[model samples]
Target: MTPIESQWIERLKQLPPKRVAEVLDFVAFLAAREERAAAPQRLSDGLARLVALALPAITEDEVEDEIQAARRERRASQQEA
Candidate 1:
């Protein structure tokens, strides 16, 4: 194997079982955090494409009305909480 892989294996072998499990869990958490961060960009990219195609069909007034409605709903929910 490569030098880094060999070194990592040797280091892991010296650690206790609990420490090894902790390292594995931490690595998994890092991977998941990275995936979660990328998910938003992927979603936004898809939405941008849709907006580009649909922009001509929707009026600015409709967009503003929807924005106002969303803000009102958000405020109402926050007040409830």
Candidate 2:
């Protein structure tokens, strides 16, 4: 392990079990906070890549048509069953 990790381990070993548990909970909270902070950046990066692809946007009518087609397929499958 790294020196910092070793130091952390030594400090943790000196603490009571309850204190160690609290430290663990705090570390988890910090990690989750970091992930939450990164999520929006990740979403923005994904959207940028999608925009870079220059794909045509579907119209609302097209979306409705897809939904209707899916419903028709489901009905057909249910009838077959």
Candidate 3:
């Protein structure tokens, strides 16, 4: 393997069984942490792609107006009920 990998193996070999297990656990935790960090970005990217496809020409101002209108309509209906 590479020199860094060889060095790591040698260092791990110097440790006791319990310490080796701890190191392995820590490595797994780091990998899991990395995966968790990337998951949100992946979700956001997918959402952006869906929005682009569904509303290619929609503007932020238009979205805000639509939201305000919907809120007003809902409130009016609630008052009637």
Candidate 4:
């Protein structure tokens, strides 16, 4: 391992078992936090790919029609259930 990692190992070895476990838990928490932070950038990258495809833009009326159609379909499905 690198010098920094070796230093960290030495320090960890000096700690009590309970403190070592706490350090492990903190490292796991940091890793999970990083994954959560990356999610939004992943979504933005996907959206950028779709934009790069140069799809046709819809009018406001068309957008409203789609919303209404979706609502109607949802209502019909709920009623059938």
Q: Compare the candidates by TM-score and give the number of the best one.
A: 2
Error of 2 at 37 (Å): 1.5
Q: What is the C-alpha local distance difference test score of each model?
A: 0.96, 1.00, 0.97, 0.99
**Can you tell me which runs of candidate 3 are displaced by over 4 Å?**
55-81
Off by over 4 Å in 1: 51-81
Extract clashing residue pairs from model 4. Answer: none
Give the alpha carbon lDDT tens digit for every residue of 1-81 in model 2: 999999999999999999999999999999999999999999999999999999999999999999999999999999999
Clashing residue pairs, backbone N/CA/C < 3 A, model 3: none
Return the TM-score for each candidate structure. 0.56, 0.74, 0.60, 0.60
Candidate 3 per-residue lDDT, tens place, 1-81, comes to 999999999999999999999999999999999999999999999999998888668799999999999999999999999
Angstrom error at residue 23, model 3: 0.2
Residue-level lDDT of model 4, residues 1-81, one tens digit each, is: 999999999999999999999999999999999999999999999999999999999999999999999999999999999
Q: Please identify model 2 stretches exceeding 4 Å from their true place.
A: 68-81
Model 4 error, position 33 (Å): 1.2
Local error of candidate 1 at residue 50 (angstroms): 3.4
Q: Is 1 or 4 the stronger prediction by lDDT?
A: 4
